[model samples]
Structures are given as C-alpha cells and as structure tokens.
Target: MDITVAEALVRCLEQEKVEIVFGYPGGAILPVYDALNHTSIRHILVRHEQGAAHAADGYARVTGKVGVCMATSGPGATNLVTGIANAYMDSIPMIIITGQVATSQVGTDAFQEVDITGITLPITKHNFLVKDPAKLPVIVKKAFLIAATGRPGPVLIDLPKDIAQARIKFKYPKTVELTGYKPTYRGHPSMVQQAAGLIMSSERPVIYAGGGVRISNAAPELLQLAETISAPVTHTLMGLGCFPGNHPLFLGMLGLHGTRYANQAVTECDCLIAVGARFDDRVVTKVSGFAPSAKIIHIDIDPAEIGKNVRINLPIVGDVKNVLGAILPLLKKKENGAWVARVQQLKKDYALRYDRGGMLKPQYVLEKLNEFKDDDAIVVTDVGQHQMWAALYMRFKEPRSFLSSGGLGAMGFCLPAAVGAKLGAPHRTVIVVIGDGGIQMTMQELGTAAEQKLPLKIFVLNNQRLGMVRQLQEFYCEKRYFGVDFQFNLDFTALGRLYGMEGYTVETEEQLLEILPRVLTSPEGVIVNCIVDPEENVYPMVLNGSPINEAID
Candidate 1:
C-alpha cells in the first residue's frame, strides 16, 4: 500500500516487532516524529539526543533486540556520537535515525544540517543516507537485521526532510542481501567435534562467558553444556546477568577487578571453553601468562574476534547458543571432581570482601539497593566505582535483569538507560545507580524521564569527584587529583528540579532509609542524591600488568 517514507520507516520497524524507540524531536526531524504518533511503536522522548542514544543502547543490551534512536541534524546528531561509539565498542545492536536538510539544501550547510552518515561511518556496522522515499522500507529492514545479527553494532540512517515527507509504496523484504554482512550460524563440523573431544578428554574445564552470551541469548544452552559436564563458569563484567550470580557453578566476575579465585581458576584450567567471550586484555593480564597450559576453544558470532586477542586451538564461527547446542550432546559427562573441588577451594580462599567504614560506601549503597529490588526489577548503571560495586553486590537471578556499558565503560550511561529500561519493562521498577561524575555527564536524561512521566528511581552517588580516575591516580599517578576532583560542585538536586523531577539529598544512612522509600512510593520520577566520601575507591582492583594477588586493597 502507498505510504509516506516516515510511515514506511515505522512500518518496517513494527514489522520487525520493535516495541519501543528512544529519541528527541527537532525541526528537521518533525516529519518522522509526526508520523510516530500514527504508529503503535512506543517512543521514549529523552532529555537529550545523547540520552536517547544511550537509552536505545541499554534497551538493546537487555532485550537482545535492535534498539532504535532518533534525532535531528547537526548538534542533535553530533550529541549521539558518544552513545553510538559506546555501542560500537560494546558491539550493541542499534539503529540510529537522524534528520538531515532537504535534498536541495544538502552540502550547503543549511541550518541544523550535518553529514551524520559520514560522521558515524567508522563507528557503525554500516550507514545509509536515504535520499529516495522508496528505499525507506528496505533500508530500515536492512538496518535492523545488520544491527542485531552477527557482531552486533550501531547503524545510522540519515533521512532528508523532503524524503521523510515523500510518498512511497511500503514493502518490507523477507531477506536482506549484503555481500559484507554474511554471518555464520553453524560451526564447522570438524571444529565442533574437536572442541567436544577436547572437553571430554580434559582433566579440568572452565567456560568463560561474556556479553555476547547475553546478546545471543545463549545462557540456557551454555548452562546446559556446563551442567552436562559439570564444568565451572567464569564471567566477564558484561556477562554478569547471563548466568545466575548465585549459582554454584558460577565463579563470579573475572577481569581487572575480578575475584582472585575467578582469575586463578581460569589460569589453572586444563581446558578453556571460551563461549561468546573474547579474551580481552583486562581479563587476561599477561597474554603469554594467561591459561598457558590450557587448550582454548573459542566460540563466537564474529570470526575475527576468535583469534583477535588470544590464539584459539579450536575455533567455532557461529552464534554461541547454536554452537553450544550442537556440542552439548556430544560432550562426555566426565566426573572431574578434583578440578571442581580445587575451584571451590580457591573460591573459599579468596572470596570477595569489602571493609565496612564510617562513611557511606558505594558498596553499601549497592547492597542496600539490592534489598529493595524485586527479582524482576531492572537495574542500569554507568561506568566507574558504582558499576563495579553493583556488579559485585547485586545478585542477578535472571538474564537481562542488569544493563550497563560493560564493553565501552561509558561514564554517563545510567540516567537515560534507566528511561529505556523503564520503557522496555514498563511494569518492573527501573533503577539507575550512577556516580556523581557520571550523573552530571548526561544529566539531561532527567528531563526525558519527566517528560515521559517515567517512574524511575535514580540514585546518584555524590562523591564530588571522578572516583575511578581518582583511584587510577592513586595507584598510577601517585594520588595526583588533577582534573579528577569536582571542586565546583553541581547541585544535583537543583539539576533534577530543572528537569522537573522530584529531587532529595541523603547524607546519612537514616536519611537514605527514610527518603528512598518515600521516593519509590511516589508515582512521578525521583532522584535521590546520596552524598558519599569523595576519597572512596573500589578496592581489590588488579593493577595493570599485575597478577590477581597484586590487587589494590
């Protein structure tokens, strides 16, 4: 049937079963926004364009769908760069739409005009500039497919104002044809068999999980394979929610700040079944020293990632879920009791611990936040001390329960992410745990929450400094707090008020106890600014190029 290009865009998205999109409106993008009102797809109006992009990213990370965001040209599109690049680094699946000047005004530097496609090219999986109204359906369909399939990442689509208003016949293609976009879903039979043989015959085995597991929804299959052979599971920071944190087989987080046991367990394993996880530098301190004796079997959706960082003895180029499913039945149910015992012993020896102090600690805030959270509540976080604390303190029971910028480690991720999480899981409570530095970076998302009437509980851990950088300075820069301390304090309460959200500051534990309940009870959005010690740092951090035992206390 005949439809406007803007309608066709929405139609294509709807056909893909996209339930929600995050965006901000502008003059150039008014056509798309106008068309949005006619579609069933839920639009989350973010406070800033950057927030919209991050909100889309958070939604995609949790739901395993191609999250979508929109913005106008020039500054609006430029603002999305950080979020888009953040998605690019983390391999998130997202489709970012931006408005451009009319076809006649292209390249003339018209008001609010920018070459968004050109700017985002390197950061995206692929990009398109739609000058033709007829290409809307195919481009939208292609964008979603490319963003979600294989090594997922952000894709940009720039639409000229005239194009969005132009009429077109809507037709969603059943299949996409892109020569460079081919993704392998089946592992080479020989490689799969080799991996299975290695696992069955090995004396010790460990499954290393990452964000890819969650992205590919391979948790069930991964668990099945681990249980089939009774192997232990170690997770990367991004992999936190993929496996139940409380599960006995789970070895908790492993990385720069990973537990000593988790690090040593992988190091000592005879066979490493790396599923949906690349051996990032953070996880493997010294590449030559990491799992030196273990035979590596790498299964990933992206073939390039298999040997990018670490050499793989057996490489399976396919989705983690599909590969694991194929090899599960072939795996021998061997009784490696000694190996399991050793892992458990190591875990007991080096369990995660934090010293309780007089001042309010980020870890304490996280532990207490856990108390108020339901099994279904969605928690989003930005990078820094708070993110790690949430990872360490929060026990995620279900997949997709946690969302954060694990790969990119974006500082200003939580606020708008909370908005997206709320939209994705409307009935569930969406909480954003962010540090003071992170909150201020993308504080505009508060306006998004207020405009949309999203009832999100935002906890800003106000330390008045860049906590992570300060910690880095302590260890690496000899405690030089250059550009790390926020001497010119930003009143978060006033900022929240500017965004039209109720704001409260808590200085004491009693204040937190007294105010958080009141904040949550309210139907409108609220920001609880918790004052924390500026000097506080996340402890047990493994120094760069050092062993797990060399962790900063």
Candidate 2:
C-alpha cells in the first residue's frame, strides 16, 4: 500500500515504540506536523527549539533510549546545536529530525532554510539528508540504531518539504542492514586478560569511572569487579550515580573541581583502570603528568578514543557492559583491603564539607531538596558551580535519576532538560538546579514548561556573577574579577509571573526553611531564586593545566 512519506516516517517511529517527542513547528515542517496529528505519539511543543533538543537529551538519559526531537530548518535547527553538542560530548543517544525547504529551494536560502546536515556533521555520530521519499524508513531506522548502539551520540535526519509530501510504500523494517554502521560490541579477549593481569600484579590499583558506565548500564558489573579486586573507585563528572556516593570503596569525583581526596588517590595509584571514560583535560590537568607512576589500562567502545588523549598501556576496545562482563570472569580473585582502607582514610581527612555562612548555599538547597523528595525524583543541572553543587550534594539512589551536561558542560541545559525529563517520567519530580548566568541563557523555556503544564521545579542560584570563572580568577588571576562580574539584576519573581510560574526568592537560610516546603508541596511547578555568596569558590579545585593533586582550596 502506498502512503505519504510523512505517514511512513511516523509509522516507523511508532514501530520503534517512541512514546514521547519534543518539537517546534515551522513553515517548512507543516506536512510533518499534519502527519503528527494522525499519530498517537505524544508531542511536546516547546517554546524554543533549544528546549526541544535538551528535553530529548533529558528523556534519553532517564529512559536509556534514543531521544527523539524535531525542528524546522535555519534558525530552528541551529538553535538545537548547543543541545546536540551537549548530548554528543556526553555520549547520549539522540535522534534529531529537522524539516528543510523544498528540494529546489535548498541552496537558494529560501525563507527559514539552513544546511543543518553540514552544520552538525562533526558533532553527530552519523547523519542523513533525505531528498528521496523512498529512503525515509531506512534512514530513520539506521539513525536510531546508530544512536542507541555502542558509544552513543546524536544522529540528524534532514527531510525536504517535497519529500515529506511525496507518496511512497510504507514498510517499517524490524532490522536495519547498514554496511557502514556496525558498532564494536565485543572486547578483544587478549586485551581484557592483559588488563586483568595488571590488576592482579599491582599493589595500589584504582578504577576511574566515567559516563560510559551509565551509558552502557555497567554499574552493577563495575561494582562487582571493584568489590572482587578490592580496588578504590574514582569518578569523573559524568560518572556519578554509577557507584553509590557514600560507598566506602568510592573515592568521590576527580577533575578541575574534583574533591582533594579523589584527586590525590588518582595521582598516587600505581595502576589505573580507566573504564568507559575519556581522559579529557578537565579530568587530567597535565596530560603527560597525569598518572605518571601508574600503568593505564583503557577500555572503551570506540577505538579512536583509546589513545587520543592519555597513552594507554593496555587498550580494550568494545562495549563497556560487554568488556566489563568479559573481564570479570578472567580477573584473579584477590583482596587488597589495605589499599581500599588507605583511600577511605584519605577521604575522611579531606572530606567535602562547608559551613552555611549566613547565606543560602546551593549545597544546603540540594540537601534539603533530597530530604523533601523521594528517590524516584529526577535531578538536572546546567554546568558551573551549581552543577558541582548538585553532584556533591544530591544523592542518586537509582541509576538514571540524574541528568546533566557532563562532558560539554553546557551552561543552559537544566531548564530545557527538565522539560524533556518531565515528559519521560511524568509522575516523578523533575528539578532543575542552575546558576543565574546559565538560567538566563535559556530562561525562555519557562514558557514551554508553563504551556505544557510540566511539573518541573527550577532552582536558580542568583549569585549576580559567574561563580566558577570568578573562582578561577581568584586563584589564578590574583583575585582579579575582570569580566566575570555580571551586574544584571533579574527579578525571578517578576520573570516567573511573566511566564505564568510560581516563583520565590530566599535570601537567608531561614527563608529557605520556610519556603522550600511550600514549593515542594505545590502541585504546579515552582521556582526558587536562591541567593548565594558570589565570592565563594568550589573548593579543592585543580588549577588549570596542573596535576589533580596540585590544587588550591
């Protein structure tokens, strides 16, 4: 039976069991929008295209699926760039569908037309431009398959208006056969054995976990291996929630804003097992000097990332879940309790603790939030001081309860991400913690939240400055504030009212104590404008370009 390409596209998505979609309609996308009304898939209309993309990311992070988002060409597609790049850096699975101008008007720069395929080439794992209606099903199927497979990333499909309107036979293939798209799933047995051998021989061993553990759902395997070998575990920004934060075997996060004890443990270990993580500069300040005394065993799904940054003594290329599964059986079962004890002592000595200096601290805010909410609630954050605060303070009891822009560290991720997260899990409490600067970047999403009636709680840390940059300037620039001072005075209450949201600002700890409870109980989403100390810095920060241990508090 012949059908419109638009019908085939929606049918394919339905076949794949896509329940939620985030998108914005436009002139070039009218045909697809028309088809959208015929499908049972729930569509969220975001106020801005960027919100749609971030919402998709949030959904994918929580559900462990390829998040789907749609937008029109030109400015609409370009707006999604930040969110797509954010997902790419974090290895999140995302499938983006954008509507382009008619085939004849592509290069002529027709109204609301842009070359999104070219713009997103480097960032996406793979992309396709569907000028032919017959290719729609194959391209979409392949795109989702590529996005959700090993070493996940975003995939884009640009459909011309003519193609969407054209008629074609609809056949949703259950399996896709793409010669150029096979992902590495099994680890080399020899390489896995070599890594196990190193673990057996080393006196002081540590496992540095990253976002890959969560992406591959290898947290259980990782915990089991760490327990069997008695090795201390340290995490990158994205590695949180993979291991329990309060676990004695877990040595908190490591990086520019990493805890002092975690950094010291990484620097002092004799052998390092890097699992599902890239040695980005943020984590390894001095690339050459990082783990100078340790033999590095790198395991990842993508072969290109094996030695791209830090040199690996043993490299295992495969899916993290698969690699960890294979290596567990080969590992020589032994206990190194002394090494684990040593890390525990380090953590106790240099524990992350802060005093509530009369002002409402972001840490206190997160803690109180936890006290009020359940484990099923989802937490999202934008990058900066607030991001670190959420990581350090928020306790994620479940695997997929936390979402943020870990790799890209994008500023305006929280608000839009919460929109998607709420759509994915409507019954769960979705909270967004963002710095003032980051919040302002995409504050327009408040309109989307209001319109969709998504119960998303947003906490804005109104410090009146870029707190993270100011921290850097204070340590490295001899306390020179420079361009870091942001004087924009935004009235959160007024802004929330403008977007038809309930807003409250807490300047003192007592105010927080009184207002937070009320907001938590409110059925409609609420906003907390938390006033914090602008001069405060994220402690135990590894100075830029220096080793993790060389940090200034």
Candidate 3:
C-alpha cells in the first residue's frame, strides 16, 4: 500500500514500540504533525525545543529505552544542540528528528533551513539526512539501532519537507547489518585472567565505578565483585545509585566536590580497579598524583577510552557486566581487614557535616528530603551547588533512581526532565532539586507539568545567586565576586499557583519542617521556594594544581 513518508515514519515508530514522543510543532514539520494525529502514540507539547530534547533524555535514562524527540528546522533545530550534547556526553540513547527545507531549495537557504546533520556531526553517534522516501523506514531502524547499541548516544534524522509529503511503499526492516560496527561484549580471556590476578594479589584494592556500570546494568555484578574481593568502592558523579549508597564498603562519590574519604582511599589504595570508568580531568584532578602508587586495571566497552587520559597497567575492553562476571570465578575471597579498617577510619574522620543551628541551608533541606522520600524515589537535579549537595545527601538504593547532566552540566535541566521521568515511570515518585539560577532558565516547563497533572515535588533552593561560580570567584579571584548575585526575584510560590498548582515558601527551619510533609504528600504538583543561605558553598573542593586528596573545606 502507498502512503505519505510522514505516515510511514509514524508506522516505523510504532513498530519500534515507542509509546510517547516529546516535540513541538512548527511550519516546516506540519505534515509530520498532521500524520501524528492519526496514531495512538502520545505526543507531549513542550514550551521550547530544548525542553523536548531534555525530557527525552530523562525518559531514556529511567526506562533504558531509546527516547524520541522532534523539532522543526533552523532555530528550532539549533535549540536542541545543548540537550543533544548532554545525552552524547552521558551516553544516553536518544533519537532526534528535525524538519528541513524542501529538496528543491537545497543550497539556497530557504525558510527554516539549516544543515542540522552537519552541525551535530561531532556529537552524535550517527545521523541521517533522508532524501529518498522509500528509505525512511530503514533510516529510522538504523538510527534506533545505532543510538541504543555500544556506548549509547544521540542519533539524528533530518527529514526534508518534500520527502515527508512524497508517496512510498513502506516496509520496516526486520534486521539491520552495519559493516565495521560490532561492539565487543566479551573481554579477551587472557586480559580477564590478568585482572583477576591483580585483584587476588593486591592487599589494598579499591573499585572506581562510573556511568557505564549503570548503562550496562552491571550493578549486581559490581556488588558481587566488590563483596567477593572485599574491596572498598568509590564512584564518580555519574556512577551514583549504581552501588548501594548505605553499604559499608561504599566510599561515596570521588572527584571535584566529592567526599574527602573517597578521595583519600583512591589515593592510598595499592590496586585501583577502574570498572566502566574513564579518568576524567574532574575526577583525576592532578593526573600525575592520581592513584600514584596503585596499579590501575581499566575495564570498559569503548576501547578508545582505555588509555586516553591515564596510563593503565591492565586493560580489559568489553562490557562491564561481562568482564566482571568473567573475572569473578577466577578469584578466591580475601579478607583485607586492615585496609577496610583504614578506609572506615577515613570515612569517620571526614564525615559530611553542617551547622545544625543557623539559617536554612541547602544541605539540610536535602538531608530532610532524603529522610522523607521513599528509598525508590527518583531525584533529578539541575547543575550548581544544589547538584553537588543532592549527590552528597540523597541516599539511592537502586539503579536509575538518580538523573543529572553529569558531563555537560547543563542548567535548566531539572523541570522538564522531571516531567518526562514521571511520564516514563508513573508509579515512582519523582522530585526535582534545582538551584535558583537554573530554575529560571527553564521555569516555563511548569505549564507542561500542570497540563499533564503530574504530582512532582519541586524544591527550588533559592539562594538568590549563582553559588558555584561565586565560590569559584571567591577562591580564584581573591573574593572579587561580581555578576553572580541576583538583584531581583520572582515569587516562585505564586508562579506555581499561576500554573494551577500548590505552592509554598520556606525561609526558616520551622517553616520547612511544617510545610514539607504536606507538600510531599500532596496529590497535585507542588513547588517549594526554599530560601537558603546566600553565602553557603559546596565543601571538600579541590583547588587548582592539587591532588584530590588535598581538597579544602
């Protein structure tokens, strides 16, 4: 049967079992929007193109599925760039579709035209510009496959207006075969044995886990390996929630703004087993000083990341779960009693602390949030001091319960992301912890949540300043803080009410304690404007040219 390419595209999406799509309508993509009206797929109308992309990203992180988002040409397509980069850096699977000018206006710069495929080349795992109507189904298939497979990332498809209106007989491909694109799932036998040997022989071993552990769903294997070898575990920012937060062996997050004990343990360990983690500059701090005495055993799916940033004594290139499973049987259990005691001592000595009596603090709010929320609740945070604070205070017992813009550190991510996360996991309680500066960046998303009637607990830590940058200026620029403080503000409580939701203002501990229970248990969406101390900053920060262990409070 013959059908318009736009209709064929929708059919292809249905074939992929896509239940929802986040997008906004525009002139160039009118045909696709018209075709969507006939399908059962739910489409979420976002306030801006960037919100659509971010929402899709959040959806993918929680569901472990390829998230789909769309936008029209030119400015609309350009707006998706930040979100696309965010997904790419974090290895989230996503498919981004953008409308383009008709083929007839190829190089003439027609209305709402831009080379989106070309612009996103450096970031995307793969992208396509569809010129043939018959190939639309196959292109969609390949895009999804590429985005979800082997170190997942964003893939884009540019559909010209003329092609969307063209007629074609659509047949979705049963399987895709891409030459020279096979992912390595199993580690080399010799390398796996060598890694086991290192684990068994070392007296003091520490496991440094990263986002790949969560991406490959290797949390169970990671836990087993850690327990089997009796190694203390420390995680990167993205690796949070992959390991149980309350476990005795867990050293908490390690890196900039990381825990002091985690950094000290990593620095002092004799054998460092880096599972599915890259030696990012933020984590390594002083490259020469990182794991200075440890024999580094690196395991990752992407071979290129093996020796890119740090020297590795042993490299096992394969899936994290597979590699860990292979190495487990080769080793006998060892009781590193002294090493465990040493790490525990460090944990106790540098425990996280804050003033109990003072103005309302962001840390205090997060700790209270942790106490009140369910263990399985999902927390999404925007970048800044609050992000670091949330990472420090929230306790995550399961994987996929925490989501944030780790590598890109994009602001304005929490609100829209919370929207998509709630839609993806309707049974789970979703909360948003965003800073005052970040919330204003995409606060318009409140309308989307209101329309969907999502019961989200949004806590805006209103410090009335860009706290992170101000802290940096305080340290680096000799206390010359400028362009960081906000002179004016909006009534966030009233803003939530304007969207037909419940709102509250919390300035003191009494107010917070009184209102939190009501807001958290509310059936309707609610936003709490928390007035935190303006001068408060994230502690245990690593200064320039200093090793992670030498961080200052």
Candidate 4:
C-alpha cells in the first residue's frame, strides 16, 4: 500500500520504539503533523523549538534511548541549534527531523527556507537531506542507527516539504548496516593484558571515569577494577552518577570546581587509568600541570578522542564495559590499602563545606534535597551555582540518576528537561533544580508540565542574579557587578500557580526543610521558589591558569 512519506516516517518511528516526539508545528511540517494526529506516537507540543530539542535530550539521558525531536524550516529549525549542540558536545543519542521548503524551491530562498542541514553540519555527528520519497524509510532508519551507535550523538534528517507529501510504499528495514561505520566493542586482548599488568605494577592509581561509563553501563566493571587495583575514583561533570557518590573510594568530581582532594590525588597519582572520559579543558584546567606524574592509560570507544585534548601514555579504543569486563578477570587484588587510606584522608581533610547556619543557602537546600531524594529519583539541573551545589551535595547511587547540560552548560535546561524525563521514566520521581536566571529562560515549560499532568518537582534557587557570572566578575573585574543581577526578580511560585500548578516559597532553611519532602510527594506538578543567599559562591574553584590541585574557596 502506498502511503505519504510522512506516514511512512511515522511507521519508521514506531518501529524504532519511539513512543514520543517533542516538537512544534509550522507550515513546512504540516503534512507530518497531520499524519501524526492518527498515530499512537504522542507528540509533545513545546512552547519553543529549543524546548523541544532539550526535552528530547532529557528523555534520552534518563531512558537510555535515542530521543526524537522535530521542527519546521527556517527559524523553527535554527532555534534547535543550541539544544543540538548541547547533545552533540555531551555525546547524547538523539534523532532530529526538520521540515525544509519544497524541492521546487531549492536554492531560490523560498519563504521560510534555510539550509538547516548545512547550518547544523558542524554540530551533528551525521545528517542527511532527503530529496527522494522512495528513500524516506531507509533514511529515517539510518538516522536513528547513526544517532544511537558508535559514540552516540545527534543525527539530523532534513525532509523537504514535497518529499514528505509524496507517496511511497512503506517497508521499514529489519536491520541497518552502515558500511563506513563499525565501532569496536571489545578491546584488543594484548591491550587488555597490558592494562591488567599496569594495575598489578602500580601502587598509586586513580580511575578517571566519564559520561561514557554511564552510556556503556560499565559502573559494575569500573567498581570491580577500582576494588581489584585499590584505586580511588574521580569523575567529570558529565560522569556524576557513573559511580556511587557515597563510595569510600570515591574522590568526587575532578577539574574546575572539583573537590580539592580529588584534584590533589590526580596530581600525586603514579597511574591515571581513564575510562570513557574525554580530557576536556575544563577537566584539564592547566594542561601543563594536569596529571604531571601519572602514566595515563586512556580507554574510550572513539579513537579520535583518545589523544584529541591531552596527551596519553596508553590508548585503548573500545567500549568501556567490554574492555573492563575483559580486564577485570585478569586483574589480581592489590594490597594498596595505604594509598586508599591516603585518598580517604584527603577526602576527609578537604571535605565539601558551606555555611550551615545561614538564610536558605544553596548548598543547604541541595543537602536537604538529597535527604528526600529516592535512590532512583532523577535529578536534572540547569547550569550555574545550583548545578555545582547538586554536584557537590547530592548522593547519586545509580546511572542516569543525575542529568544536566555538562558540556554546553546550557542555562534553561532543567524545567523542560524534567517534563521529558518524567514522561520517559513515568514511574520514577523527577526533580529539576534550576537557578533564577535559568528558570526564567524556559519557565514557560511549566504550562507543558501542567498540560501533561506530570508530577515533577521543580526547585528554583532564587539568588536574584546569574550566580556563576557574578562569581566570575568578582574575581576578574574587581567586583564591579554588571548585567548579572535580576533587578525585577519575578515570583516563581506565583508563576507556577498561574500555570495551574501548586507553588510555594521558602525564605529560610527551616521552612525549606519542612516543605521539601512534601513537595517531592506532590501528586500534581509543583514548583518551589527558595530564596538563596546571593553572596554565596561555589567553593574549591580552580581559577584561571591554576593547576587543578590548588583551588580557591
């Protein structure tokens, strides 16, 4: 039976197990939207195209599935750029489908016409411009496959209006094979053996894990390797929940705004075994001073990333889980108890601290939030001081429990992300901790949550300023604060109520402590506006040109 390419596209999505698509409707994509009206696949109408992309990204992180998002041509497609870049930089799996002008209008700059595939070429892992109706099914399948495999990232499909409306016989492929792309899953046997030998010979070693650990589901293997080798573990911002935050051997996050002890341990370690982490500049604050004495063994699925950012002594290109699984059995337990003790001492000596007796400090709110958070609760964060506080104080014991815009450091991520996360993991509690500045960026998503009747806990740290920017100005510009303060700070609780959700405002620690638990249990969507101290700063910050070990509080 012949069906419109739009209908065939929907069939492909169904085959891919795409239960939802976050999108906005426009003229160019009318046929697709019209087709979607009859399908079981739910479409979430976002207030903005950017929200749609972020919602899909949030869904991907929590569910470990390739997220789907769509938008029309021109401004609609361009609006998805920031969110697409966020997914690309963080190595998220997402499939973005955008409608383009009709094939007849190609290169003439028709109404609402723009080269989205060209615009997004640099950011996407791969992208396609579909000019033929017959190839729609294959292209859709390929897009999802490319997005979900081989160091996952966003892939885009630009469907011209005429092709989407054209007729095609629908037949979704059972499997896809991209001839030019095949990722290595297992590490070379010799490399695995070499890793085991290095573990046996090293006395002082640390495991630097990253987002890849969570992506590969290698936490158990990572734990076994750490335990067998008696190594402490530290992670990047994107790697928050790859290991249990409360583990004794855990050294917290490493790099800028990292724990002082974690950075110190990295500085002094003899062997740095890196798994599934890219040595991003933020993680290597001063390249010359980073891991100066360590014999670095970098393990990642992407060979290009092995030496792209920082020099490595050994490079193993394979899936983190598979490589660790191979190496774990060969590894013998070492008696590096003394090194473990030293790492623990460092953690204890330079523990994360903040004002406990203050008016609703951000850190205190996060600590209190930790108490109410279930082990399985998904905590999403927008960028800035609140994100840092969550990183420092929240106890994450499972992968996907902590999701944020790590690489892009996007400000307006949490609120809309929480909506998609709740939909993705319907049974789990989803909490979005955002700052005043970030919340205002996408606070309009509150209406989406209310419409969906999602019971998300939205916590806003109302500092009345862009906290991170203010902190930077204090250090760099002699404390002459500029453009960061919200002079007309709106009441977030009132805004939530306006969106038909429950709302509350807490001015003190005691007031927040009493309300947070109940807020977490709210049956309908709710928002809590906590007035936090503006003077507070995220401590243990590694300043510019400073080594990761020496931080300023």
Question: Which candidate wins on lDDT?
Answer: 3
Model 2 lDDT, full chain set? 0.86
User: For every model in order, what is the number of clashing pairs?
Assistant: 0, 0, 0, 0
Write one digit per residue (lDDT tens) for candidate 3, span 1-553: 9999999999999999999999998877888998999689999999989999999999999999999999998888999999899999999999999988898986788888899999999989999999998899989999999999888999999999999999998899999888978999999999998888988999999999999999999999999989998999998888999899999999888988889999999999999999988889989989998999999999999999999999999999999999999999998988899999999999999998877667899899999999888888999999999999999888898889999999899998888888889999988989899988999998888888888888889999999999999999999999999999899988888988999888899989888889887787778788899999988889889999999999887
Model 3, TM vs. native: 0.99
Model 2 lDDT tens row, 1-553: 8988988889988988999889999977778889989678989888889889998999999888889999988898999999899999999899999999999998997898899999999989988999889889988989898998878999999999999999999887778788776678889888888888898898889899988899889999999888888888888878888887667787878877788888888888999999999998888988876888999999888999999999889999988989999989987777777777788889888888888776677778878887776667788888898888777767765567888898778888889888888877888888888888888888888888888888678888888888888877887789988887776678887787777778888888788889877787688778788888776667777766788888776
Model 4 RMSD vs true structure: 1.1
Q: How many backbone clashes does candidate 1 have?
A: 0
| Number of clashing residue pairs, candidate 4 | 0
Off by over 4 Å in 4: none
Error of 3 at 488 (Å): 0.7
Residue-wise C-alpha lDDT for candidate 1, range 1-553, written one tens digit per residue: 6788988888788898988888888988899999889678988777788898999988787667788999998999999999999899889899999999899999998998888888888899999999778878888888888888888999999999999999987778897688777899998888888889999999889889988788778888888887888889988887887888778889888778877788788888889988888888878877777787899999998888978988889999998888888898787677689998998898898887766667777777788888777777788988998888788788887778888887678888888888777877778888888888888788777777777778888889888888888888988998777998877987777877777778888877777777766676577677788888777777668878775545655
* lDDT (C-alpha, whole model) for all candidates: 0.84, 0.86, 0.92, 0.90
Q: What is the Å distance of residue 133 in model 2 from its true position?
A: 1.5
For each of the candidates, the C-alpha root-mean-square deviation to the true structure, in angstroms, is 2.2, 1.8, 1.0, 1.1
TM-score of each: 0.94, 0.96, 0.99, 0.98
lDDT value, candidate 4, whole model: 0.90
Better of 1 and 3 by TM-score: 3
